[model samples]
Target: MRDDEFLAERFEAHRGQLRAVARRMLGSAAEAEDAVQEAWVRMSRSDTTHVDNLGGWLTTVVGRVCLDMLRSRRSRAEQPLEPEAPVPAAVPDPEQDVLLADSVGSALLVVLDTLTPAERLAFVLHDLFAVPYDGIADVIGKSPAATRQLASRARRRVRGARSADSDHVTPARRRELVDAFLAAAREGDFEGLLDVLDPDVVVRTEAGVTTGASAVAKGAATYSRHMVGVPVPALVDGATGIALLRDGRVERTLAFTFVHDRISVIDITTDRERAARLKITLL
Candidate 1:
């Protein structure tokens, strides 16, 4: 067989995943197919013998290609393009079925269209596919920190857009509020801590529940002083939360519930075993 034919076969093996990534990023079947084809072309032209992680490499390439396409589409001032193919009722393969279900949804696509190219790519790749920040950084040509911010921004926009008709807090505002609480706790600023908490805030811990702003603030001060590691911003089940990472693993997770721009409830998960099982990606 020809070398090109062998390469084509290898590319075909990853076609499903590649298409899924592109489809989510571009939100159009025709554009997704074009992006995947472009990725294949690039792979065929390069010597990939030294590529240890072919799947990851392809994903990064496809992601970058899609990002470029999104920028180009924006430059033209065009509307959000629709899928060229008819929307299927169902996909046979379960893995792809999940991808399709997750990617599709009129409300989500509308929200996704509002994001900038970089933000959309960052959110879709990391939040949706669990691609590491490092992998995303390479594609977006930014530092991991910048990529994290992009994803966070996109996540906030998505959340706010989805609940536009409601009272959902913007992602940026949520982070800001959470950061203020953390900062207050870290500094042992009792009043500062209470400032960000709702008057009747409730904190659920493994031991029991604590109520009232002062009580919650006191507990936060104590915990912050003894926190094993730095508390990093993260998306916990689609809500902005904080995760404490020690020795490269999550030691604890504090999921927050916000009301009227104040923290209403803090659901703390301190079970080391259970904490270790969480799929956390630091923002």
Candidate 2:
């Protein structure tokens, strides 16, 4: 085989793994594919004659590409543009798609969205993929120690979000918390809102992210005063949450993540297109 053909074969061997890393970092399948393609393009043009581990080199390349994409994405407005039609797959595999989505739970994706680009890159690479801190630091232009700290912070946030599934927090109790949150919001009860929110609670929406219990509670109280439609309990992405219905049609959805008995995260979906895509089952 020619030298180029040999290189292509090696790249194809790692494509699946590279795509998985990108998918977790980006949270968008299309963007992940783009990042992988960019990595291939860079490798095809560069001289890797001295490279010892091809897999590690390619992973670093994809990490850099994903980091740039994430930073660019954050620089843009919070309101995403209308999604373009997805490119047709050369060979569609619905099962593979389902498996990938299941592996990366929807709640986890929501928590990842709240992280900064650098924090997300460090955590996803080091914690999830086991990429060493030195390599992650190179991708984000930080010292190894700083990179480790980034991962540590991200890990804490992720743990808080996932703690909702702890055995101690029964599904019934979670629902009760959600019910209390809605009741407080509807009543414009600021103190009640604080009672159910974590001290460092985070609320994410297309508009932007708001942190701190007092801040989120203040906003919730203000929104409650002019709120329209009835908010009802629902299952959002397999977790207990709230759905706002107007004239019998769902207009918004809020997914909650509890740490201990207080809510730590609130992922609100208000964009019409995004809201329509959420799996919300009214109770």
Candidate 3:
């Protein structure tokens, strides 16, 4: 094979692993693909004759690309973008998507989103992918010690956010809070809804993010007036949540994040296709 063709083959060999790293770092399949492609482009333009480990080189390239994307994403006020239009023959496989979601867990992704770009890169590369601190430090432009600290902070935040063992709130308590929220929503009891929500709760939907307990509660009350489905308790992505069923089919899902007995986050999924991919178990 020609030298260029040989290089392409080598890059292809590491594509899957690079894409996996980007997916976790960016939390979006489309963005992950873009980052991997950018890495391939950079590799093609550079001379890797002395590079001993091509896989590690490609990983660092993809990591840098994803870090840049994350920083840019934050500069834009960290708004979640609308779902990309489907590309011909490029639509993600439902099974693969589910597997990826299961591997990382949607709740973990939400928590990761709260991390800074450097902290995220440090945590994801070192903790999730087992990259060395020295290599990860090079990617984020930090010393190995600083990079380790970033990962440590991110680790504590992740554990505090998702690990049931780290938090005082038990699973049963979470279920009770979600049940109360659902009941209040269904009954248009605004004050009851406020009782279960944190003062600074955040609600995220396809439309946009709504913050503050009063604002979220108002929206919930309005939704109840025109609601058409039966909202039942369910474990959404392994987190206590509710699923709205219409005609025996799930129509929407509400995933909750509780902090000290009050719901701090409410992620609402209204897209049927996306909702179908969530690992939900009815309670």
Pairs in steric clash, model 2: none
Q: By TM-score, who's the top model here?
A: 2
lDDT of 3 by residue, 158-272 (tens): 5546553455678899998988988898889999999999775767676545766899899999998899888889999998899989998889999998876789788888988
TM-scores of the candidates are 0.53, 0.60, 0.55
Q: Write the per-residue lDDT of candidate 1 for residues 188-283, one digit (tens) a residue.
A: 999999889977565655554465688788988997888788799887666678998888878889888776677866777788887777767678
Report lDDT per candidate: 0.77, 0.79, 0.79
Per-model C-alpha RMSD: 16.6, 7.6, 10.6
* Per-residue lDDT over 180-230 for candidate 2, one digit per residue giving the tens place of the 0 to 100 score: 898898888999999999876878776656777899999998998888888
For model 1, state the Cα shift of residue 235 in Å.
36
Off by over 4 Å in 2: 75-103, 166-200, 207-257, 267-283
Record all residue pairs in model 3 with backbone atoms less than 3 Å apart, i.e. clashing. none
